[model samples]
Structures are given as structure tokens and as C-alpha cells.
Target: MTDEAIRTERLSKHFGRTVALEGLDLEVPRGEIFGFLGPNGAGKSTTIRLLLNLIRPTSGRAWIMGVPVGDVRAAHRHLGYVPGDVALWPQLTGMEILTYLGRLSGRVDTAYRDELIERLRLDPSLRARSYSKGNRQKVALVAAFMTRPDLLLLDEPTAGLDPLMEAEFQALTREAARRGQTVFLSSHILAEVEDVCERVGILRDGRLIEVATLADLRGLNATVYDATLDGPAPDLSDVPGVASVEPLPDGVRVTLTGPPGPLLERLAGTGLVKLRSHEPSLEEVFMTYYESPARPETGLTARLDR
Candidate 1:
């Protein structure tokens, strides 16, 4: 089997003059938790549908585990998917829905399905029509996880989930990665992506903007430090990582771009009474790219950057 679980070759799709996706070349290696991020109408859902072979691309090709998406029946058998907008048989109970899907899948582990249902706090006895949006989402999540497929495609999987359930979902994602499942998670929730994804692809206006590992993105984020010192603040204006400095009533507020070692060493030169630092959230990091003109990800120079 190939090391890559998913690969796209200049994949594109269009409707009339409306381009849903354009020239998207991507590769998702097996056993990695990869996040797909974008704003609304950014073609994220369109990409998911193409990869699942539910919608044919206007141009380009995609492969899953070396098998082309053209043979969707064969390619999809090894994968489980959760759509952003889940539609179920209104009259069927959650249990019935799972059972029907399980029978179709031909290999669902019943015990695992029940465990997932319990973990997601879903009441399977209730009919789909009676379930709330979050509950319906939970049902889809349970169905996806229960199959324990080799690859999982999740789009906005946590949209209707509450904070507590969102945390549980993160735990589930980690467990899935540990089980060697390749997960392609598409979400607008930056914090969830930061928590679960090893690497991420950001899309904009049907085009891939960039791809970066969490570590690579962290380098672009700036950290802020508020200090209360006994004496005058040390001279850090010339420090390599120091971005800016502000004199306050108590001490200095410093913003750092890269490593903290230089800043720390500089601060040590003076008497340090107290110090606190706040790291930028992943949302803040994402904004840097979203707001700025496109810069190729320094690390993904060959693919995403180009």
C-alpha cells in the first residue's frame, strides 16, 4: 500500500462560471491527523464531496490508498465519512440508522458501535425527526467512528456540539490517530484544529492558500509577555526575536516573534520580580495569513507554496 492515504492531482470543479474548486493538488499521508480549514463558501464542502466521489470534479483526479476515486464503491469501502449537514431517515431511530448502515458496511463491530453511541451521549431509541441538530451530529459521529475504517472524512464534525462534547470529540480524534486511522477533518473551529491536527491545509476562494504543520504555524505567531520588574527594563530593542516593546506603569510589555531564549536571557540581565507570557491562539496565527497577501509556506515549498 502507498504511504499516502489521499492524493489529488490538480483537482478542480466548476458549475457554469462558478468555480467551486480550482487546481487543488494535495496529499494526505496515512496515519496522520490532517485538518482542512477555510471560511464559508471557500469550497471545503465541495472538495469533500469530490474526494468521496459523490460529485465528479470538472478537472483533475484523486486517489485514495492508490485506488482512484473513480471507482468510488471500492475506494469508499475503506473509509467512513461525516457530512457537515447530516440528513437521516426522519422516521428511523438512531439505532435503526446505525444498524442499516452497519449492514451495508458489512463489517461494523456492534460492540464498538454501542461504545461510540454511549461516549457521544446519544439516545438511539429516539427517532431522527425528533433529535436536535447536535444529537443528529452525534449520531453521524457515532456511525463514522464505529466502523473503524482506515480513513475518515469529517466535515465540520463539531459544528453543533457543545463545549463538553467538543472536548470528547478531540479525545476521540486522538484515539483515532493512535489507531492508525488517517483523518481528513474539515472545520472552521480553529481551536479544535489546533488541538487535534498534526498538519493543516487552508483554502481560500476555491484555491489552496497554504499548508503548514502546527509547529511551522507557531513560528509565525507572536507571543506577548507582561513583566513587573524591580529595576529598569533591560535593552531588548536589538534582540533578534523581539518584535516590540511597550513601557508600562509597572514594567515592560514585550512581543516576541520566534524563540524565547534570547528574550529570557536578556530579561535575566536585569532583576526579574514577576513575568507572564501569553501565546497566540491558532485563530490568531491563521489570521496572519488570511489578512496578509499569500506567502508560500516556507516548509511546503514544493507543493502548497508553489
Candidate 2:
């Protein structure tokens, strides 16, 4: 089998007049957690459905574990998916639904399934229709995780979950990756994905805009630092890396464009009292793409590690 968990070549999808995803060429290597990021209507959900072969692509093709996605049964055996919006059999209990799905996957590790259910705090005795959104999400997550397939495709899986459950979900991803399962995390919550994913692919208006490692994403935008001073505030305006310095009531907020070494050296003797540094969120790093499509030359992608 190929080392690639997923490979898409010019994958395009259309629905009548609307082009959902366009000419996307991407590869997700084995044992890597890849994040697919885009805002709603940016074709994030459409792309997930296409990978699951729930809908045929208008053009191009996709492969899962070196098996063409067109061969749904074979490809699906190696994939576990949680859609952005989850649905379950209304007449069945959560336990029944999971049991049915486990059977369908043809590899039901009953002990692991029960462990996930308990860890997620799911009351599976409740009928599917009676479960709240968060409970339903828990059920779906359990179903996906229990199988422990080769590839896990989670599209906005944390929605409807509380902070506690969200934390659990993140932990589960780490566990999955540790077991050598490749995770394809698709979400608009940039920070959530950035916390666990090694690589990220940003999609905008049906196109792949940028792909970068987490470290590269850190430098793709300027860093913001806030400092409180006991002594006279040093003039950071001329510092080599300082982009802009704005005065705050208590102190000044400095925006550093590149290396922080120059700024740190300048502040050494300034008698700093309290200082806080903030890294730009992935969204903030690529706001240009989300904000405007007309301006195509963002030039920020040049810094990404290819």
C-alpha cells in the first residue's frame, strides 16, 4: 500500500451552477495529522463528502490508502468519518446505532467501543432522537474512534461540544496519531486544529490557497507583545524587527514583524515589570485570503516550508 493516506489530483466538485471545490491537488502522508481549514461555504463540508464518496466529483479523482475513492466499499473500509452535521437513526438508541455501525465496519472492538463511550460520558441508553447535539456528537466521535481505521476524517467534529468535551476530543486525536492513524481534521476553528495538526491546508472559495507547517505558520504573520514597564519605556519604534509600536494606558503594545531577537536585546535593561506575548492565530495569519479574493498576490505563501 502507498504511504499516502490521501491523495487528490485536480479534485473538482460542482452542483449545477455552483462550483463547490475546484482543481485541488493535495497529498496527506501517512501518520500525519492534516488540517483542512476554510470558512462555511468555502467547500469544507463538500470536500469531506467527496472524500467519503457520498457524492461523485464533477471532475478529477481521490484515493484513500492507494484505493480509488470510486471503489467506495474498499476505500471506506480503511476510513472512519464524522460529518460536519451528524445524523443518526431516530428510532434507534445510541447503543444500537453504534452497534449497527460497528458491525458495518466489520471490525467491532467491543471493549474499545465501551471505553470510548464511557470516556465521552455518553448515555447511550437514550434514543437517538432524544439526544442533544452534544450527545450526538459524542456518539459520532465514539463510532469513528472505536474502529481505529487507517484514516480518520473528522469534519468540524467538535461542534456542539462543551469545552470539557472539546478537550477530550483533542486528547483523543493525539492518542489516534500515537497509534499511527492519520487524521484529516477539517474545521474553521483555526486554533483547535493548530493545537494538534502538524500540517495545515487552507482552502478559500473552492481552491487550495496555502499549505504550511505549524512552525512556518508562526512566522507567516507579525507577533504582538504587550509590556508593562517600571522604568521609562524604551523607544521600540526603530528596533529592527518592530513593525509598529502603539501606546497603551498601562504600557505600550509592540508589533514585531520578523525576528524577535533585536527587540529582546533592546528591552534587556528597560526594567520590564510584566510582559505578555501572543502568537497570531492561523486565521489572523491568512486573513487576506478570507477577507478578499480580488487581491491574489498575498506573497505570504512564499515563507511556507514546501
Candidate 3:
């Protein structure tokens, strides 16, 4: 069996003159929680739809659990998916909806399904039409987890969930990973992805810009240090690896790119009261890509070790 849960090659989808996705290539390993991140109109949904084979790609190909996406039945047998916008049969009760979906997948673990329902705090007896948006999301989440498929493709899975429920969702994701199930999470929520995913791929303008672990991404950018001093701050502009040094009210704010050794030595005897290092958050890294100009080519992959 293949170690890859998902793979794509030169995947492109064009709606007339509009390029939804272009020449994309990616691979998600088995038993991993990989995050797909981008803003609206960044082709995040398009990539999922192509993987699901809901829409035909104008060019290129994709596979799920080593099964080509062209064979939807075979490929789907190894995966469970939760869409950004869920639509359930209005006449069916939540439990009925679950039953129908379970039968279709033919892989439901009834005991586990019950546990998920309880954990999500879902009232399965309620009719679909009466359920609020968050309740609908819970039902979908339960269905996706109940199957325990090889791969879970979740697109904005926590859309309507409250903070508490969102936390529960993250917990469930971690549990799934521990069970050796791979999760492909496509979300605009940086915090959610940063909390669970081992690695993240940032997409922009229909292209995969970068793929790396959170630590590696942060390492690629400058590190910020805020120093509070009892006296005047020292000049760090000439210090090696120091990108920029700004005078703060109490001391100085230094942006360092590489080793901190040089910067630390320069700050010595400068009346340093406190020194704080700020690693770039996922959101900050994400914004950097969006704010910067798009690269001329795709496949800027940064597959780094943890």
C-alpha cells in the first residue's frame, strides 16, 4: 500500500478565462494532519472539489489513498469529507441523516459514532430543518469521524461551532491523528491549523506558494526581540544578523534574522532589564505571503524536518 493518502500532479482547473487553480502539485502523507491555508478565492475549495472528483479538472490528475480520483467509488472508500457549506435532507432527523450517510460509506463504527455524538453534544433526535448552523456542523463532524476512514478532508469544518465546540473539534482531530488516520484540513483559520496540523501549505492566487512546518516557516522569517532597559538602548544597526533596531519607549525593538548570539553580545551591559523573543505566528507568516507579490512560478515547496 502507498504511504501517501493524497497526491496530485500539475492539477489545473480553469473556468473559461478564470484560472481557479493552476499547475498545482502536492502530496499528503498517510497518518498526518496537513493544513491547507488561503484566503477567499485562493482555490482552497477548488482543490478539495478536484480531489473529491465533484468537478473535473481541466488538466492534471489526483489520487486518494493511491486510488485515482477518476474512480470516485473506489477512491471515496478510503476517505471522509466535510464541506464548507453543508446541506442535509430537511425532512430527515439528525440520526436519520447519519444513518443514511453511514450506510452509503459502509464503514461506520457504531460505538465510535455514539461516542462522537456524546462528545460533540449533539442532539441526534432533532430534525435537520430545526437544527441551527452549529448543530448541522456537529452532525457532519460526527459523520466524518464515525467512519474512521484513511483520510479526512475537512474544509472549514468548524464554521458555525462556538469556541468550546471548536476546541472539541481540535481535540477530535488530534485523536484521529493518533489513530493513524490522515486529515487534510483546509481552513482560513490560522490558529486552528497551527494548533493541530504538523505542516501547512499556503496557497495564493491559485498557486501553492510554500509548504513547511510552523517552526521552519518562522525560522525563515525574522525574529523580533523586545528589550526593556533601565538606561538608554545600545545601537544594534551594525550588529551582524540584526535586520532592524527600533527605539522603544523603554528600550529597543530588534528584528533579528539569524543567530541571536551577535545580537545578545551587543545588548550586553546596555542596562537590559527584560528581553523577549517573539516567534512569528502562523497568521503573521500567512499574511506575509498575501501581502507580498506572487511568485512567477509554482512548486515553492519547503519540506523541512521537525
Among all candidates shown, the one with the greatest lDDT: 3
Candidate 3 off by > 4 Å: 226-275, 292-306
What are the TM-scores, per candidate, against the unseen true structure?
0.80, 0.81, 0.83
- What ranges in model 1 sit over 4 Å off? 224-277, 293-306
lDDT per residue, candidate 1, 242-283, as tens digits?
655778788898767667888888887798778898875676
Model 2, C-alpha of 42: deviation from truth (Å): 1.0
Please report how far candidate 2 places residue 260 from its true position, in Å.
Answer: 10
lDDT of 1 at 172: 91
Residue 119 lDDT in candidate 3: 90
Model 1 lDDT at residue 81: 93
Better of 1 and 3 by TM-score: 3
User: Using lDDT as the measure, what is the rank order of every candidate, best first?
Assistant: 3, 1, 2
How do all the candidates rank in terms of TM-score, highest first? Answer: 3, 2, 1
Cα lDDT, model 1, residue 277: 87
Candidate 2 local lDDT, 4-101, one digit each (tens): 99999999998999999999999999888999987677778888888988899999999999999989989999998987678899999999999999
Worst 10 residues of 2 by lDDT: 297-306
Q: Candidates' lDDT values, in order?
A: 0.85, 0.83, 0.86
